[model samples]
Target: MPYDFGTWDRNCNAEQSQPLTGTLTGTIPSWLRGSLVCNGPGLMKYGDHEFKHVFDGSAMLQKFTISETGMTYTSKFIKSFAYTTNTEHQQIVVSEFGTRGCSVTKGFLSKLGSKFQFDKMFSDNPPVTLARFGGAYYATTEAPFLHRIDLDTLETGEKVNLHKLLNLNSQCPHPVTLADGATVNVHSAVGPLGPRYEVVKFPPTCPAGADSVFAKPVKLASCETRWKLNPCHMHTFGLTEHYALLPEQPLTVDVTAMVANTIKDKPLIEGMEWLKDKQVKYRILSLETGKELKLKVKSESFFYMHIANCYEEADHLVFDVTTFETPSLLHQFKLENLRTKGSALAGEVDSGCIRRYVVPLNESVKAAPEENLVKLPGAQATAHRQKDGTIFLTSQKLSDVAYENPVVNPAMERKPYNFFYGISGDMTSNKASVGKVNVRTAEVTRWDAPDDVYAASIAFAPRPGATAEDDGVLLVHCVHAERRRVSLWLLSAADLSDIASASFTLATDAPRALHAVYMP
Candidate 1:
């Protein structure tokens, strides 16, 4: 099913490519869009300049220096992202590899020659990896291929064919999604071989007897032109060395009922006509072996969710798990002792903690109307893993849980105005705050920020040679904590009480962002 932008909210004025609904056209506002992109820091060494992109929505370039303190990188931004000390060189650097475009209108609008293009031009769905080397780095702007560049050399290195790398031919949709929900229909053409069978010639075949046969390319008898679009996806896999673990929720289809309900002149139901009432399958995969393993987790479904974050403490894998209707969950899976050959895609081979969290689903909290009680369309959240094992998650918790006009019946207005006002009758802005969870003890804590403060990014910095108690340092981004401005917060790592704060008035205001990359 294709995305329907108008169905979720009529008030949305931004023309979006899909119906993921949260911001305009379900896209993040330009300011807020930048907020979410501030997740991971990149180190690009250019000759004498050690350019580190310290994220706070707008990328801030810093000079990296090494001293007895460990490693220190200074940013021009008000609050600095401090690193203890290291042996890395220090220099000034800038990235031509800046944001392809603001995620707001750039993704949804279909305009040629425009500075922004749909996120589809590049891989936007699954989390992408960005690496930096001396005066250079590697990134993939398109599917089916990966590119590396020597920032100093200005030479494009060898292209790694993702299809060959992952062993999936044209059958896969380039393992990317349109930042907006639009599709470029590519007609099948004869290849040098014959019918142009999608081939995997790069990354060699999977290990013998691996779960390679599980996720057979979904062969549809016909294109999904008529099926009602299901916004929730089962899984969105991020890449790791020698593996691309994809999680998914199965599509429900019923051949008999599909045919009976067909009012169109023609209905195309071929191989998978039997999929009607089947529950969606949610699991993880081992790209090397094509192994599909089910995750013993449940929660609310999401079309757009930040799936993974790097946590050295979590054995490198910390994931946000939630079902469409279930409470939000944070799960940490360590690579230690965990095997991928079995039916249990995930297990407690080691140990981690799960916490119960909620993103308000009421009319007041949702950017759209139909979402009354924690069921908003296209609500996105990100959980950042600090240097320690603790995880900090950003979400909007509504001050009010009930709405005067509940959409229990279809006959009610599909879209509602003044609906938010009614739901927020007694709501407080500061009520929507960021929460912290300790994976070891499963202890939970909340920090109430100003009403306008939307917690966007949370990072950690430990003092040199400091113990757990001494590692009380943090860097937080409040996209709008300071009146549509981007503000940085320095806080106690042990307790999220603010230590210091600095503000930067955006030349242009933005929505609270979801990710950031910190550099010391």
Candidate 2:
């Protein structure tokens, strides 16, 4: 079966269930009966069955659900961390590092309540994904390293160098060339790994790739600065955690530079897209042998979208694809394609079924938009696939959002930082919308929220006794237009429609494209 997971974030001052009571399955909390109470931080604090915890950067945790008895408040947790020091970018944080440590309300309450200032163990970069191994949690960090933590005891552990496993330093050359017989110490870095933005692969000792987290990550291959001079380029895969997929972004230089010192008007954006024909390839690496199986696809017809993992009675994989200029489409495949015999045609995997969805921008809205029209190019929206094969994708239809900003991309003109150089669209927006896609029917539905509401992060809340038509709730974390004020919204999973909206406080607003985790 194919599945797509989605989330919801809304704006409103609503009630919450204190002293959370009830049962939780998967990531959804069952709310009993309770009086309508004002909200606090949405964190799932575990005090006296309260289970309160503040999401990182949030002033207060937004309660997601309450039991009819007012016993439990289900919530989600978004974390940030600091890693080791690197003076190279001054912008990269390295202090206060820890796995699943930096949270919003905790950052604030620690200051006010005289708690152990847990903010110090911050990660150098935000975490992309976290895996649990040997009772410990291992998370990938921007400092290009993975940190280990004790899941049961919440204790810190060893750190593994991700750059080393990817063989970045060895595959790419050092001492980048400079003018006047000089060289600058330059090295390539690995991009984020996950569904849409990173390399995809199954971790360790898992029978099926779908629904399995990376248990033990082994190195596959590496690249020099291919995407750009620094190449903050990230890739995505189609198979569940089953296969390791690496897309190629060729490395180019100042082709016109060797001839004359004349300032070639060649722009960086154009440089990144130079070889539109060079296809994005992937490698399926054996966690045991370190041997890689390569696969190439028809680069022109399909650009990478995201990967979905399915683990029902059988294992399956879904790859979301879109043309360089088309709607997002999903392609389904079998998980066997990653193995030796079955993977021979790795490059020949079926296009399977295709599902495409595009946010209607040019169309007129029944209600006048509160702010300036939402900028286009939200084309960079992210998606989450639910276990039931439904897909929820955020769209660029929110108001007050700047779609393309010249100010943010000034570095692209001069070869700015690897990742930031090519970043388009304004992630900042008061309002945003999410689209729902049915893998079986290829049908599409949409839900839009208020302006200044930042709900880029979404998730699927566990449902009970509900069918595919009425089984799940979409959970979203939204920052209100007022700023520093965050809220939550529960949406019916089946139709991508709103259920309820609640408001809470945050120490600071969350970064636009951050990750959130749902704890049952």
lDDT of 2 by residue, 394-511 (tens): 3222222111100111111112111110011222233455545433333445566665554545555445454443355656655555544556566666665666665554343322
Worst 10 residues of 2 by lDDT: 416-425
Instruction: Indicate the TM-score of model 2.
Output: 0.44
Alpha-carbon TM-score of each model against the true structure: 0.37, 0.44
Off by over 4 Å in 2: 1-123, 127-129, 148-159, 163-232, 240-244, 249-277, 282-296, 301-305, 308-318, 322-430, 464-470, 507-513
**How do the residues 1-520 of candidate 1 rate in per-residue lDDT, one tens digit apiece?**
1111111111111111121112111211111111112322322232343322112122222222222222222222111111101112232211121222211124323322222221222222111322332222333222343345332222345444434334422222222211222111111113343322221211122335543311122221111111333212222333333223233333322334433323221211111132334333223333345443322222232322233221111122233322222211111111111122121322221112221222221113213322222332332333333333223334333221211111111111111111111111112333234444332333434556555554545544445555443253445555452333445555555665766554444322333323333334
